[model samples]
Each structure stands twice: as C-alpha cells, then as structure tokens.
Target: MEVIAIQKSAFDGMKNELKELLEMTEKVTRKYTPIFKAEKWLDNQEVCLMMNITKRTLQTYKDKGLLPYSKLNRKNYYKLTDVQALLEAGQPYNTDGNGFTDQ
Candidate 1:
C-alpha cells in the first residue's frame, strides 16, 4: 500500500467543518422534531381506566374513528386531550337504534 499524508492545516479545517455540520444537524433536529408532553401521552391501559372502558370498546372506538391513537411497538397510545374531547362531545359513545353511534 502507498502511504499518503494530508496537510495538518487541511485536516484541522475538515475537522472544524465536520463539527459545524454536527451542530447544524442538532439545531435542525430540535427545530423540526415533534415535541410531545410525556404526561399527555397515555398508554392503552391508562386510557381504558380513565375512560372506564374495556380494551375491546377502545378498539371499537378506534375502528369507528371516535378516538385517535398512535401505535408504537405493538402497543396503542392516546392523547389525554383527545379522550377528554370525546368525553365532552357526548355523541360518539351514545349508541342509536342501529347499535352503532352516529359519526
């Protein structure tokens, strides 16, 4: 193999550029990445308990678009705000004569 040498000044400049690139990347990530309140994010069990509904009913809510959820790692998560909104709406959970709630 042939030995090649790079100028120390050139190497230092390249290193500085790389550092700047890393800092810029971090700034962009912070700017663009979605910020979620950890407490606002509720897992399935927490939502079920809070809503006083079973898991099956929760699935039904999802199927009918009554509740919005995000699935991660094969587990479902819901926003507390959305759940509270549903409770306040007082329409989605009430079933009609057809046994399905009106959307």
Candidate 2:
C-alpha cells in the first residue's frame, strides 16, 4: 500500500512535468513561425478566378462586407479561408439575370 502511494505520486509528478514541457514546446514553435505563413493570400485576379466572377463583382462582395480584405501598398489581398467559408455557405451574391449587378 505504501509503495503504491509512492508510485502514484511519482507518476503524477512525471505527468505534470510532461505537460509543462509540451506547453513550452508549443510556445517556442509559435514564436518562430510567421503568422502569415498559415494563411493563403489571394489577390484580385486569384479571387475572381476562384469565384468564377469578374473584378467588379469581387468589389461588390467587398462593398457588401461579405468578404474581408487588406490593402498592401496599392493592391488588395484576401484570405483563402474567408473566401472558402463564403463558398461553403452557398451562392455568393446574386448577379440577377445579367452577369453583373448594380451596387
């Protein structure tokens, strides 16, 4: 019984130490990885191609706040995940019977 108690305490200590080590490793990995490395960036052309729409239509999406974007210098950039989420939700914005819509 006494040996069992000793073994249990030792096991608990090892588990706690292991948890700490894993957490530290995660922190170090995150610290060295570039945040943008995880996100795939899409420019106007790529976004249009991916959505099978025109540049003007892409602008409509931005105007409607359906997609989030960032401007780097003179060019606009968007995240692949954001666009993919909208696609997964069904149709983008309706263009009516025409190929475009008046925003």
Best by TM-score: 2
Residue ranges of candidate 2 with Cα displaced over 4 Å: 1-33, 96-98
**Global local distance difference test of model 1:** 0.79
- Give candidate 2's whole-model lDDT: 0.83
Model 1 reaches what TM-score against the true structure?
Answer: 0.55
Residue 99 in candidate 2 has what lDDT? 69
Cα TM-score per model: 0.55, 0.60
What's the lDDT for residue 98 in model 1?
49
lDDT of 2 by residue, 1-103 (tens): 3544468789999999999999999998887467558788899999888888778788888998999998977999999999898888964666655667744
Cα error, residue 7 of model 1, in Å, equals 26
